[model samples]
Target: MAPRILLCGDVMGCLNQLFKRVSSVNKSAGPFDALFCVGQFFPESSDQLDEFMDYIEGRAQVPLPTYFIGDYGFGAPKVLLTASKEPANCGFKMDGLKVCENLYWLKGSGKFSLLGLSIAYLSGRQSSDVQQYGVYSQDDVDALRAVAEEPGIVDLFLTNEWPSGVTNRANASDVPAGLSDSMGSDSTVAELVGEIRPRYHISGTKGIYYAREPYSNIEAVHVTRFIGLASVGNKDKQKFIHAISPTPASTMSSTEIATKTTNTTLSPYTFVEKGSSPKDTTKRSSDSVSDSQYWRYDVSQKRQRHGAGDGDKLCFKFLSSGSCPRGQKCNFRHDFDAREQYIRGVCFDFLNKGKCERGPDCSFKHSLQHEGENYADRRPRSENSSSKRSKECWFCLSSPNVELHLITSIGENYYCALAKGPVVEDHVLLIPVEHLPNTLSPSAEHEVELSKFQNSLRMYYKSQGKQVIFFEWVSKRSSHANLQVVPIPSSKAALVEKIFSLAAEKLGFKFVAKKFDSDSDGRKFLRAQFDGNSSLFYVELPGSTILLHQIEDNEKFPSQFGREVVSGLLNIADKADWRNCKYSKVEETKMVEDFKSRFQEFDPNC
Candidate 1:
């Protein structure tokens, strides 16, 4: 069985460094069985975060399981990476108290579970707040009490925050003297831990504060500190391990239940070569140092020791393969097959980006080639054919004067069209199928489908080396969901100029150059003139002091300001009415004039 090694700390970018150190250590200590990653820095988005998990898992590919315990979003379901099943997006609640077998996400807090306590409910607040200070209200206390009473439960109470104290409240008579005295004034988490001692406690917060010696009731206390390992081995031998040296070398501080030997020597792997032995005072003809100065591991002692004798022993053991007559193998031969294989597997699995020779038989399908093949070849023909179809009007099913093509097809009439413009490729317009007023809420099913479609389209376009600018406009006048797409320009200057020109011509907005004084209080707003009418839009461009605003008549314009704003920004706009245009024009015109006047007032010497 692999050694069950738990790495608990405030994990930052130390994962890569940790793997390297672990690899070096395994040369002697051997490979650990399981790795428990306990702390914050867990990625919220599965796509964004999987790289780190994959890295660790890949390195320790020798069936050494790993598990992560941390805070996740409420109602966010656990993602099962092993089977590629649809991830759970609901609250974090465990079906069973113990998460047994394989890589698992032991939900930290929230949700209804018999054994697991929702830290949010217990704290009478969100999980985030509870994690920061470990504070809990009265209502939260009640919820915790109810969960504690549940029978036949082996609960390893996990929270992103640590409790004020760690003690057993269930065994009232056996309660520690310090905890019993402080019970009344103790916080909710403290009281709960004092009453019912869970098997394990993992917190995301930092700091290490262990009670005095003979701390047996509590199993293991993991805290994030600059100090090294503090207390180890759960409740049994509660020894506080402090660094003999001043500063902490690792992020986590451990307090062991018992004191262990402190070896200050760096591992043999970390060594600097010297030309010759101090006694000899003679350098070899070759620049490289002789094997005498190199560090070597002592197999019998199971530790790294320096000098010639050590290297000779290691060389014989390794070179002779334990089969030489009279046991005359190389001195440094240490048969560490298991450790070498485990380390090799981990490096090959996670660190290396080589393709899998076993193909489907390989556990980690991490090859970029596989991803490309899956995305390109595995898509359904129907979806592919649909993508190739021309853009037609959602209402008339005929091509518009704009020579529009439908990019997003949400069934027959429900489609989003794009107008191909010379300046911007595939300038798009989104329109709904049925001619209903522009009030539409995408159904959950629609959202899922649309999101997936959008992602695939973006990926496909990106793979093909094309850039796209997506825009949407929904107007109440025509019960059509209008969406627009513009092709992105290759040159930065060209793209900006193109967008500015397009917005000025089509949307009656203009981009102007203006300067502001160093002490100017307000940003300069631009005046957008269109159709003998004008409005103000804020623009804040690089190397310019003016704020660019996309302004339009709120009431008098044919298009709603909201819709126009979305279109101008190349973002989705909410649908709104354009009925009371006449009433809105007076106020809108004044607003634009006022903004333009302010810009002129702030003009340099003015």
Candidate 2:
């Protein structure tokens, strides 16, 4: 059954009147599962402190199961601080604190399942000074964004302040009197609501009632209804409480849920440029990274170049940022594959300008491998040498050059080794025990063990507040396969896809992106894409986004492509080449020991 819920505006310590109204409604409307309060649940004046303490001190009872945000005001600091210190309220508890029996304080920002309904909320107003308890931080805003990316619809979103531009596209008469154009709303909340697309968005801070017309959300099947209520017992007697009994989205069929009303209007949020469509603007804006070290691309025109094009000549504009103004209509070809084939065995800048400026820093092949002492000659023997035998392969456990101290863990068919020139701390390599050329052809037993190690690393890194990315380059050469595992800051997780896409554009190639449920599924998909015979590169990003590319037999693809992209994401492009990031034997051994000690609990082999 769908849950019956009651939503209230700011109480401001008017508990007697609020519950009197709630009790009258409960008796008539009878049983509501829960009452959710927005805006200031606590009072702003000391005069109402006695009445507020009645409920907090258990002298008076909360009429129903109540959950509330807006946890700031007169008496809130003392009350909430006391609740936070309780051991029962520790570590991300969704049900929140059992504040004086039936009342619950939904502190901070989070999403939780309430009687099958997905309820997400942000407590407190936006402020530059996050040290104050009355305001939300960037971390809280970002956490909700991560929640927005999760599957399923948000039944309700509660915020303390109004989303800026909430009045747009609404009937003028519907807006309450004396409301300003801005309505003192927060743009961050606006951006969040646009992303979350909750079925109902409720807020209360201005002490005025405004029930907006249902508006359509970008890329969503259902529409969102926004309602801003006035404070409880306001002088104007504006509506302060709303009743809703929405069926859980999980129970509704897609077609039924997609059904829209005739009153639906365009979203009030104008997030992009004037001429661009909402979907196009969303894609580009969502992929953008603010880091100064990383470059942004013109993703708007990227799709136009994906269609059929003529000639093998490279499009210079497309080569720089993955988009061409002329697109397919351009005389020159805009294909990354064609550019890759053309640039093989030659430096791209050198080919275009008749001279290369990067000198030793350039990663591209200035000359073929057969040419004496090229860039390939300076790489590690394990990665670049032609030794095909396990006895001679530098990565092999039996090989004399294999660093025994770097071996951290060993499974039935795979072993973990610290990267010789680590791109980031805790960066490790997963290698097959057998003399295997690539991971795709590994047996089922080997594949399972590989997944265990991947999961183990993921858990260990997550505990350190970091996210891990895995990438591998498989070629027709005799060298063994080693999947590079690099740890990145959790905050930069959103930038991984954008940085890699930008890097791919600069290098004149596009990676085929797909979602997979597991590492096994990812490998199977890659094998199918290449028909099990081609050299290919793939990156398993922070989440479900897997980027794949096939290497042509004659193509001189950079073996360090994965590392280069990750280094760029980390804003340490100097360490893209392993040779430049070498450590002394003592330092390397210390790193190994530190990693092993920290990783012991998560190791499946242990």
Candidate 3:
């Protein structure tokens, strides 16, 4: 047997009138297998709307699905017509077709299918003006027909506008002028039905009218004044009156038949079988109807494991739009769809940060939620290398003036360092304890820790008596790593140079020196220099350590070693290279002696 579906037009202010009418007409009317409301209107007050929707659903008693088709605000439909895997708050079942601006479909029983298409308002402009109506277009009609063409599946079309084709024009004024007269002329409701060939067509535009019989295999019905204060009555009688009246109609007969009949055949179960159950009947009834299933709120105990200290509460927030501070250029543009995609891709590249395709997978719900914090801690991890490690400086070990501060412990294999040069009072060198090839790409945890440490260093320098000058250098040959050096005032530069020179002498190594000044091209080597009175020198060290004396002369050295060293150092300083090392350590030492010999001859003051 085909399923029986009840299709109704916009409820507007006629809900009360219709409800009373239905109660009086069918005292024993069987529950509808499916109840579809083309567009339901509620009062401006959210409370009233909530109450009305709740009462309607509760009274229906069946899991009968209700849908809306129209535009609410926000220029888009606000109802969930289909299911989603990871649904957002906006996606939920039974939220009541809030502000729908599209077509909807619901299949009931075994035979009947209810299809609702919202007719876009005609503004008397071009036909394409329907786009502003926030409703379906001609293409949508074609799509509906394709779906409804299935055999044995009865289709019912309901809309606010009187579709193209239909002889009745009772309440033409009820419909907008552009739609009323022109719709029938261009494409009547009957023609549209012929196109889709639905089993039923219920429209509400023209004056009060009804078709006495069914047309073709499909039923074409019209109801003018179907909803009004006068229509509220008993099984046999109905009156035509305004919907705002509170009093019942006194003159209305109790036995007059309100439903007109024609050639269309009613399904055997139309007056018997009830509709299907709702997907979330229990949840919806127990919880607030406005409560979204996709949204959850809970408080849980949290404990820090490695990155942060123990028992520290990590508060995270997710903002949809306009959450972050927009400086001169607003980063939060509606057109950031591409940027969002890029962030998601980069986040997926690393697996540790919650496995999100977006930045900071943030899948888990944290107590504290905020926007722009997830991407706060982003850093690349270093890959392993096979180069030999350099020996520790003996002078640094023996000097009592040196201070070592452990900024952060980045995971099991790596640590960050803040080393104070012995002779240099406020001079500090920031280095990673990890023997990795590049610090540019640190582990996820390290990335976060690095940022935090940098912030702390900035604060520390500002608090001290001397200003801080920061610099970083890298080597080209060995997988280049950065060496961060911050020079502080109070004779720190001279002191650092003295310690470095003394360390080389004690270690039986020769000092390979290069002078960089503001005028020299080497000045470009500075990474981030502060404007304090103190001078700072930041040097990037090569991943592969070399003997200082071996770098002085161009002699027999490691394979392509001289070019590699010069290139690496120049790269770190962001400058052009002018000096090269010798091919051999012995010859390089000789060259260093000769260079120093010429310097001494030029300056007798020494």
Best by lDDT: 2
Ordered list by TM-score, greatest first: 2, 3, 1
Show the lowest summed lDDT stretch of 10 residues, model 3. Answer: 289-298
Which parts of model 2 are misplaced by more than 4 Å?
A: 170-173, 273-606
On residues 414-503, what C-alpha lDDT tens digit does candidate 3 reach at each position? 333323211122223334445433333456565445444444444454455443333332322222233443435433433444444443
Compared with the true structure, what per-residue lDDT tens digits does model 1 show for residues 320-382? 121111122224433222112212222122212223333432322243311232211222345
TM-score of each: 0.25, 0.53, 0.27
Point out where model 1 deviates above 4 Å.
1-7, 21-32, 43-63, 72-102, 109-147, 151-157, 165-186, 199-204, 207-606
For candidate 1, the lDDT comes to: 0.32
CA lDDT of each candidate? 0.32, 0.74, 0.30
> What 10-residue stretch in candidate 1 is worst by lDDT?
243-252
lDDT of 2 by residue, 1-606 (tens): 779999999999899999999999998996888999999899989999999999999999998999999988999889988888788876556566777889998877888878868789999998876666667765466457656655567889999999877775342236655687465588778778987899999999988888888888765668899989889999989899989999876556545767898888778764454334323323323223221101111223433675432233344434433333343344544533223322343554443443455554333445532344332112233553433345455578887657888899998899999999998999999999877878777777888888899999999999999999998887644257899999999999999888888767755688888877866687677666755456778888877668988866434355567887787677665466575578998999999999999999999999
Deviation from native of the Cα of residue 274 in model 3, angstroms: 42
Model 3, position 577, has a per-residue lDDT of 15
lDDT of 3: 0.30
